[model samples]
Target: MARNPERRNALLDAAIEVLTDEGARGLTFRAVDARAGTPTGTASNYFADRDALLAQTATRVNERMVPDPEHVASLMAAEPSRELIVHLMRDLVRRMTAERSGYLAMLELRLEATRRPALREELNRTVREQYDGNLQFHLASGLPGDADAMRVLYLAMTGLLVEHFTLPEMLSDTPEALDELVAVTVERIFPAA
Candidate 1:
C-alpha cells in the first residue's frame, strides 16, 4: 500500500532532523512521530521496523548531499580542468563541514549496516554506485583511467571528510591548512602540469 505523500514527506523530514540532532542510535519511532507532529503510530505504520526507517533516512540524506550521476557527468564533461576539480573538492568540503551532524549520522548508519547483512548489501550497492560515478568523473577529466587510483582517491576523500568532522583539531585551526590539504590531495590524485 502506498503512503500518503504529505505523511511520507513529513516522516522523512522528521527522520533527518532526529538523526542529525540525536544520532542514528537515538532515532526512535516516538521521536520521529514527535518531530513530525504526527501520531506516534504513524512511524511504525510506514516504516514497519527500525532498519527500514534507517534505510529510508540514509537514502534521503544521500539524495540531498550527493549529486546525481548525470549532473556530475555533465560537470565533468563540460570542464575537466584542474581549477574545476579543485572547486568541486572545496565545495564538497564546505558542504560536508556545514552538515557535520548529517555526515556523522551517515557514518553511524554505515557502522550499523555492517552488522546487518541485508543492510550491508544495500549499503555496498550504494557505495559501488558512488564509486562508479566518481570514476566516471575522473575518466572525463582526462586522468589516466586507473581503477586503483580512483579507488584510492575515493577512500582518501572519505577519510578526509570523516576526519574533518571527527578530528578537526588534527588538521590545525586554520582554514589555510584545510585548503592546503585539499590542494595537496588533489595534486596527488590529478597532478598539475
Candidate 2:
C-alpha cells in the first residue's frame, strides 16, 4: 500500500499534540493512532517503532522553532536592531510558555536521547543548527562575534527562558520585567556598541 504523506503529517501532528498534552509518558502508538483517526496498525506501519516516531517528532519541533537557512540569511543581511533582538527573545519566551507541555516533552526526549546514540546525534545536529542560526543573528545585530561571547549570550538567554517557563512570576511580576532583562543582557553582552 502506498504511504500517504497527508496521513504521515496527520500522525506527526497528533504525535505532537499527544506529547504536549500528555507528556512523553503518555505518548503511545495507540494514543497517536486514535488522535490521528487512523487504524491501530497504521502508526506502527508508518513509524515502525516509538524511537523512530520520537526522532521525527524532535526534528519537527526543531524545524518549527528555529529559523530556516533562507530566514537566517535574510536576518544576517539586515541591520542589527535591539528592538528586533528583544522581540525575538520575547516571542521565544511567549512560545515556550504557551507550549509548556511541548517544551517538557522535548526535555524528556533529551533525557532519553542520552542513552540512544542515534537520537543523541539527531538532537546534537539540531542544537548545532540552532547555535549557528543564533550566532548569525547575534553577529548581524552587532554583538561580539567571538564564540565565547555568543555562548554566554545563548546560555543566559536560555536560562532566562527556562525561568520564564518554570517561574512565570519571576518575569510576570511587572509588565516590563522581561524587556528590562533582555535589554540588560544585551547591553552587557555587547558593551562596545
Candidate 3:
C-alpha cells in the first residue's frame, strides 16, 4: 500500500468529488484517478478496493465538514443563550452550505451504506461518536440545552440541511428563511434563560 500521506489525501479528496458528482454507483478507480489527475491505477495503489475507497472518502468528508477550532472558540467566548444557540446553528448551516460538495458526498455515502453492511456499521459508529461529542460540547458550553434538546436540535437541523441541499424549492426562497428557521428551532428547543 502507498504510504504517501499527501497523495493518499489527494486521492481521498478526489474520491469525495467523484462521490458528489457521480454518487456511489459512478465511483470507480478510473474515475478517481481522472478526477485527481493522477495516472491510471493510482487510486488502486492507495485504496485496497472500492469499499476501502468509499470508507476513506466518508472519513475525509467528515474531516472537511467539521467546524474550525478557531471559529468554535470565538463563538464560545460569548455568553451562552438561546440567541447564541441560534447563532451556532446558523453558523453550522452556513459552513455545511459552503462545503456543499463534501456534505453531498457524505449523503451519498449514507445512501451507499444501505447496501453494504460494513459501510453501514462504520457510518453508524461514526455518527454515534459525533453525536456523543456534540452532546458533550453542548453540555460543556452551557448552551441552554439538555441531551434531549440536543438530539432534537440535531434531527431538526439535519432535516433542514437535507431540504436545503436536496430540495431547495420545498422551502421559502427568501434570504431570511434559513435564519428564521434556525431561530425558531432554537426557541422551541431551549427554554428562555
Top-TM-score candidate index: 3
TM-score of each candidate structure, all chains considered together: 0.84, 0.78, 0.97
Clashing pairs in 3: none
Best-performing candidate as measured by lDDT = 3
lDDT by residue for model 1 (50-152), tens: 8888887777667667755675566566445666667677767877776665677778778878787777777788767877887775776675536776687
In model 1, where do residues sit more than 4 Å from their true spots?
A: 68-79, 141-145
Cα RMSD (Å) per model?
2.7, 3.2, 1.0
lDDT of 2 by residue, 1-193 (tens): 3288778878877888888777777779899999889888788888878888888888767755654567546545645655556556665666666666567667767777888888899889988887897777566567444777778778988788767666868665654887788778866775654
Candidate 3 structure quality by residue, lDDT tens digits, 34-151 = 9999999999999999988888888888888888999999998999888889889999988998999998998999999999998998889888888899999999888897899999
Greater-lDDT candidate between 1 and 2 = 1
Residue 112 of model 1 has an lDDT of 76
Identify the runs in model 2 with alpha carbons over 4 angstroms from their true place: 68-78, 81-84, 95-101, 140-145, 171-175
